[model samples]
Target: MTGYALRKGLTFCRVDGRFVFLDLPRDRYFCLSPIADQAFLDVIAGESPAWVAAALRDGLLRETADDTRPVACIPPAPPRGSLHDNNQIVSRTSVLGALTRRAASRVWLRARPLKAVLDRVQERKSSRAGVELSVAQISRLAASYRRAGMLVSAHDQCLATSLAVAWQLASLGATPHLILGVKLHPFQAHCWVQLGDVVVNDQLDAVRLFTPILVV
Candidate 1:
């Protein structure tokens, strides 16, 4: 019955590490591998309106592969001109100080499973000390996501990996953001996790490589 329902609904399924088409909600049937089915089930079971939005965004990105498109390169800022003389005073101060602070708190409050995952990932990936993510402790995944995106855009790297990481963060109950920027050369936007001025996964090179721009 479950299989039949999934097939009729035109839903997606994972089977044997492959994606399968299921014509769900129409009494039709399509089959997928056990792994795909399980993953699909997990996603479904964990479904929430919030997650739905994220999934849609991710789906759209995947469908068109826009996230993979190269970001335009931005030229270096010319020395501050007379126009900036006055504005520079304020810009130099706290540009997004409030937003950053709010975001940091939000990530710490909402993030789940981030610390554990980070620990596991670190254990497996690194042997160096000082390579730990600064905000791994806080539950502020959304804030982290935003920060990560900004870092990636500034660095110019792959966005897909960042998206994957963001998705993982959202699943853990963190609010993430997608950041876009062009500096020096063309690159993809990305996401990050944060905790009170500390960056989670800062030591992970994945931040430099993946461009996760949006939290959803």
Candidate 2:
């Protein structure tokens, strides 16, 4: 928390010398103008920049008691050398179970607000004392999910699928990160699950296309 920090439910990080913001409350992503970006940096640095007052008026920044949160902070993206893929044999029964679980997740997501859904996921993730899953185990889980994913009807099933996968692995005592990411230019949002650097429910190359804005 800086003297002036991002409002609650808002977070941002730097990418390619620009600040990318994720507005969780609105469920949207955006980039600050170069001037606003520099102003934010200055505000965090304890020297109010020219646009600080305007940013405050705009509700982008709020008064903070004591500074702690960094301007840009989040988990590292999957490493280039990380284990990206693995061979696995998924049983028909497993795929069916995955389909059923993912469907439930989709229904749950549809019934709740975006922030509420993400909040519930974070609550569960914090409650569970999950273990580190082995690469082979992760592979099996991912493969089964992928097989079931083929049957999913929606193109925007990434959030539901990743949420279900993260919840599933957490129940098994495996700690998996549910990552929410965004990409600019065309402006897209995506979600995926991973264990350390190993992607759990999506391809590394695919997820790498977006920069992680939140890690739950």
Candidate 3:
């Protein structure tokens, strides 16, 4: 009765009622058939590898005599910035700037190739001046985008929100890290922007549930 476990650097998410596996180290993704998905879930939940192998009459899971790798690590939080009051008034200039960048982000996502878009974002991060925004300022910028209908009905909300926030931060001369993360079990993927480890555009608790697969 050999025990089985998910491989290191591997995560899965259920998208549109199907299980999708991500091998992070290999940068590959695989969609699992329903039977395989159930087998995987059973194995990871402490079923014997040999039992699953016999049941399927095949090698379904990797046998692990000893598994040592940590499945996830939470990044250290960044130094705290000044907290902003929810009622703080946002300046017109900041609101307009965020809206403009959000529009540009939507257009770039639609028109450009993904690699090209990522490269352009990387360039912005590298060339950004050292200016930093307060938590209040960042919150205000995100609010402005939401209020302006920039993110309304976005097909990929995480991608759209991350891009919009990244652009808004860059416009303010701050370099932001765009992050992509995955969580197994219930299986989900999420994206967000951060300054250091401080999540700029999403709830810290929410982002903490995911294991970061990419930080751009």
**What C-alpha lDDT, on a 0 to 100 scale, does residue 216 get in candidate 1?**
18
Q: What are the candidates' C-alpha RMSDs? A: 18.3, 2.5, 7.3
The lDDT, on a scale of 0 to 1, for candidate 3 is 0.61
lDDT of 2 by residue, 98-139 (tens): 888899898998788788987877777777755776767777
lDDT of 1 by residue, 63-161 (tens): 222212212122122212111112122221233442343344345424534333233333433333233332322323333434544543424332333
Candidate 3 has its poorest 10 consecutive residues by lDDT at 78-87
Q: Per-model C-alpha lDDT, please?
A: 0.33, 0.77, 0.61
TM-score-best of 1 and 2: 2
lDDT of 3 by residue, 112-211 (tens): 7655676678788778858877776777766665554443443356776688788668767898878777666666678778787566656666776776
Where does candidate 3 clash, by residue pair?
Answer: none
Looking at model 2, report the run of 10 residues with the lowest lDDT sum. Answer: 77-86
Candidate of highest TM-score: 2
> Each prediction's TM-score against the native?
0.21, 0.87, 0.56
| Candidates sorted by TM-score, best first | 2, 3, 1
Q: For model 2, which pairs clash?
A: 1-67, 1-68, 1-69, 131-173
